[model samples]
Every structure is written in structure tokens, then in C-alpha cells.
Target: MTEVDLQEPRRVPARAAGALRRAAPALLAYAGVRALGLLLLAVWSAAKGKSPHTLLTARWDSLWYTRVADFGYGWEVRLPDGTVHSNLAFFPLLPWLERLVSAVSPLSYGDAGLLVSWLASLCAAWGIFLVAELLYGRRAGVCAVVLWAVLPVGIVQSMAYSESLFTALAAWSLYAVLTGRWVSAGLLASLAGLTRPVGAAVVAALWATAAVHVVRDRKLSWRMAVGVLLAPLGAAAYVLWVGHRTGGGLFGYLDVQGQWGNGFDGGLAFARFVGDKFTSFPSALAGLGLIVGVALVIWLYVLCVRRGQPLALLVYCGIVVALALCASGYFGSKPRLLLPAFPLLLPVAVALARLRTSRSAAVLGGVAVASAVYGAFWLNGSGPP
Candidate 1:
């Protein structure tokens, strides 16, 4: 009877492990946060008299993704001057996933994108939590996930953005690299590359970390080298294909991006734009605020580097930020676009971990409520500029 009693508690059977894996505590916490966020999204849509489904699938960039999934790629629309704009500009992984889901589920292409991104965001939160736990501790991991959940830019997670999906893959891939699971890291990094252009950054981080390990060991490791080689294939192949179709080299896709006002030369042009904004009282105040915000971002990077952050994390965050900030086009979306850069959460995570539970809960609660309201406002077109 005593043996039975002990075995009962240990009866977490091997087959049941799958369910437990899916019900990860971190994932549950992530879901609670995202559910609150979705509530805000719903309220905002109701106020605008826009169906959340439509908004999810029909918005600015979502439309492009849906068209790509529904009709197929290679369909181009021509401007008056006979210039062609193809949907090939966007990466394939998101739409491809959408197609796969729609084939097996009742969800439409647009809704599928929303579903995939929403789920992927939760996965990202879990992955980040795992990384923090591995590096710091359980408390730090929890804090990191909470910070990500209530981040000022949380609204993007519910949108049709690729940030969440890329982040999930990148975080777990980096975690795998740290744990010396080279093949797994390479696989996840490859998927990340398929998800977004910045995936190359993750690949670079992995390769760099592996190289350091190899050099320190003073011997060549085929596993590490193979992992490094596998990282860039997905992104590189897609970009090369885009170049072939667009009648240029890799520069062709970049040229197409420029036509959409997204040329990447350096951040000098954006700095000049912000300088012009300082000419008026209101603009000056706003510009000053923007400058302060940028400074905070820079300060966080400095803190991480100075604190002797892990090399992989530092490089990953640095490359993502540099690419986003230095990209000449779409200055307005810089903040939103850089949401996938996960390393920025480290300092805040570290701080939160040291706080007492009561204090941490109070702070997270306030941020959660405010984030909900801000998300609603953004959706309703009344949010901060």
C-alpha cells in the first residue's frame, strides 16, 4: 500500500509527458498575459466597429501576407510607370505556415497568421524564460517573461508581425547553442532565418559562440562547424532567390525595399529627420523625448556589454539594433520592428528578480493594466505618437 501511494504521485507516465510539455508553467503565464492583451485588442476593435478578424488579417502588412498565401507568390501589381511590385518582397515562412494551417483548419489565411503569431509569441516568452533560468535563476526567468509580456510594445505580439515567431525560434536556438546542442541550435536558427531578415544575426551569434568554444578546445569539432554551416542556408537561399527573380543580385531585394521607402544606408538620414522635428516647440519636446528613449536603449546595451554579458547575446542584440536603427527607411517603425531583439530585456529582468515578491507583483500588475489600455488605444488609433 505504501509502494502504491508513492508510485501514484510518480505516475507522470512517459506518454503524458507531451501534455506536460505543452502545459509548461512559463507558457501558462505567457498565455495569461496574452489573453489580457487579446482582451484589449477586442475592445479596441469593437470601438472602431472593426471586426477583430478583419483587423487581424486586413491591416497594412497583413494584407500582403494574406495575398501571398491565398493567390500564391510571383503576382505583381504595376504602377503607372510600369514599375512592378511583387509580393516576393516579404519572407516566405509566415505565409507558408499560414497556408499549411489553412489547409488543415477552418481558419482563413489572415486569421491563420494571427493564430500563428499569437501562439508563437507565447513560445517566445517560454523560450526567453528558459534562457533566463539557465543563465540567472528561476526568479530572473519569471521576471524576464513578465517584462516581455508587459513590454510597452506588447501590442505588436497580437498583430501580424513576424517578431514573435522569429523571437521564439531565436531564443530557443540560442539556448540550444548554450547547452551544446549544436544540431538543434542550427535547426532552430534556420527556421528563424526563414521567419525574418534579422535571423542572420542569430546565426552569426551561434557561429561566433561555437567558434570560441572550438578555439578554446584547441581542436576542430565537426559538429560545431556543421552547425555553423547550417545556420544561414535558409535566409541566404531565400534572399538569393529573390535576387534572381528581381533581376539583380542580393541587392535586388534591397532595391525593391528602397522603392517602398526602406533603403538601408545608415541612421544619418533618420537623425537629420529628427533634427528637423526639433524646429517647433511641440516637435522639439517630442524629439527630445525620442532622443531620451534612444539613449535608454543605448544605455541598456552599454550596461549589458560592460557587465560582461554572454557574447552570443551581446552580438545578437547589437546586430539587430544596429540593423534596425541604421536602416534608412521606415524610421517610424524602428521601435516596433526591433521588438524581436530579446537581449534588451536582460537588465530589467535582473532588476525585477532582486525585488521582493509583493513589490514585483505590484509593479507587474500596474504595467499589465497600463499595457492593456495602451494596446487598446493603439488599436483604436489614439495611442502615443
Candidate 2:
């Protein structure tokens, strides 16, 4: 063979190996946590005569996503109560990926979705590690990934949902922003916008950071200008398309969500939902749990602010929390919606970094096991919708 051919063959494998080596730590942690969750789910589901894989790959929102993948949009279901649930409410990127992957492989749309979510979750973990590593150190970065994996709703990361895909984009976009790679950040932010509605959080973070930089320097660089201009296009394009298709003009997308009883009421609906939980004696405990959960979320954000987390992370996380807590629909789905707000765990990661290696490992391991059990139980019962 010619010298060029020899070098090309060697370079491909070498680069692949190097990339895998670099990502091994985060990927391994992600795989371990997800495997534990799957294992527990399998055992629990087998006992209850349910299909764990179906739960992960086909139930709830996963079904909607796959439906969008198999058949293009414009699908809706009307209940006997006259409520209409439209697939347009779901962003398109996840289903797009599902269609692309299933077209090239033997996997069904559901399996393709599972595959996409699995790989995206690992990418999300690695991106999260990079962000934490940039802000703190490698130890804290590892702990941050561990903390994310052990969160109560972390199991959703393994399911066929947009959270992992959006999170991977958001984390990498924030990392790019921190490193001053504005174009890359903007591109990722755009892709995130296509992945989930909260992708606005990423776009807002990029815009806010760019604005701060301009205010400080009294001028905008060409790259920053391009990035700022590019950040919102993905979401705007999708919304405009939806509007045109539904014949509702600019408000068509909002109207679709409204039909499903979703809207931004500034948390009034959430407050009433919580209060209603207290009407019965047993539900009173559930209401108290909701109070404590909200309090904890607020406390962690306060800690992040006090610790002076980077502006990009703070902006992204704040918008995520606000959207999750303020949304009026699916009160039971708040925790799953908050799964992308991984930066909120920075405080816990920093605290874990301060401990001895053995102690941190022990704590994370225990939490991983507990989270796994909880995930199995949660999925077997009435889990996130």
C-alpha cells in the first residue's frame, strides 16, 4: 500500500481509541448507573409481570416521540373529556434522530429512540464532566457526574426522552461559552432548541453572556455577533412552521399546548396543586414533601449564586428551574423536567470533593444503589408522565 493509505488507516483507529480513552471515565460512570437502574427495573418488572424495556423505550412520552418518528407530525388524540393532546408540543430533534437512525439500521423506531437516548446520556455525562472540570477540577468533575447519575429522576436519562439530548447540547454549549468558542456554543444552543422547549434556556444563556461581554468591552466581536444571531433560529423556525401548519399564525404553537392544559401561569397552578394535596391526611405528607422539595431546589440555587458559579451555568440552570416549577401542566412531572438542571448539583459535588476519596465513593455508591431501587419502584408504579 502507498504511504498515504497506511497513514490514513492507522490514524482512524488511533483517533477513535484516543477519543474513547478520554471519554472513558464519564462514559463508564454513566453506563454503570444506567445499568444498575436497568438491572433493578428488570428484576422488579419480572416480579410484577411487566416489561422493563417497554417502560424505558415505549411508554409515556417515548411513545409520542416514536410516533412522530414513524409518522411525520400533525398527529393528535382527543379524549372523551374534550382535551386534545397534540404531538406538536414535542420538539422535533429527538424524533428526527430516531428516524435517521432507524433508517440506517435494523432497529425499530422505539429501539432507535432507546439507542439515541443511551448514547446521548453518555455524551451528556461527559459534557457535564467537562463543564465541572473547567469550573472546578477533575475530582469535582467526576463527583458532579456521580451526583447527576444518582439523582432521583436520573433514570429518565436512560429512557427515550429529550432530556438527555437537550442536556448534552446545553452542557457542551455552556462549556463552549466558558472557553470563548462562541460559534460552537451557538450551534449547540440551536440544536438544543430543536431538542426541547427549554432549549430557550441555552439560547438565553448565550445571549446573556454575549451581552455581558459587549457591555464590558464596549464592542462586539464578529464571532460573538454571529453566535448571538444564530442562537434562536432553531426554535423560531420550528415554532413558525407549526404556526403555518396549524393555520394559527404566530400563536399556533401556543394554542396547541394550551389545548393540552399547559401554560405559563407563574406557578399559581402548581401552588394550587400542592395545596390540594394537603386536603387528605395521607396526602398531607405528600404536600409537605412537595414543599420540602421546592425549598431544597431554591436552597441549592442560592448556594450556586453564593459560590459564584459561571454566568452561563447560572443562567441555564435558573431558566430550567423556573420553567419546571412555573409550568402549570403535569405537576407530577416536575422532577423529570428538572433533570437537565445538573449544574444545581455543583454544591453537592464540591462538598463531595472535599471528602476523602473513599468516603466520596462510598456515599456515591450508596446513593447509586438507592437511586436504582427507587427508579425500579417508581417505574413499576406511577412514574414520571
Q: What's the C-alpha lDDT at position 305 in model 1? A: 81
List model 2 lDDT by residue over 1-385, tens digit each. Answer: 0111100111122244664565577668778988999999999999999999899998999999999998889789999999889999999999999999999999999999999998898889988887776666767888898899999988899899888999999998887787777888899999999988899999999998888888878899898898898899999999999999999999999999999888899999999999999899999999999999999999999998888787778899999999999999889899999999998998898889889999999999999999999999999999879
Model 1 reaches what TM-score against the true structure? Answer: 0.90
TM-score, cand. 2: 0.94
Runs of candidate 1 exceeding 4 Å displacement: 1-23, 77-85, 382-385
Each candidate: RMSD: 6.8, 7.2
What are the per-residue Cα lDDT tens digits for candidate 1 across 9-75? Answer: 1112234366336337657766777788778779778878877666556776777888889988777
Count of clashing pairs, candidate 1 = 0
For this target, which candidate reaches the highest TM-score against the unseen true structure? 2
Using lDDT as the measure, the top candidate is: 2
How many clashes does each candidate structure show, in the order listed? 0, 0
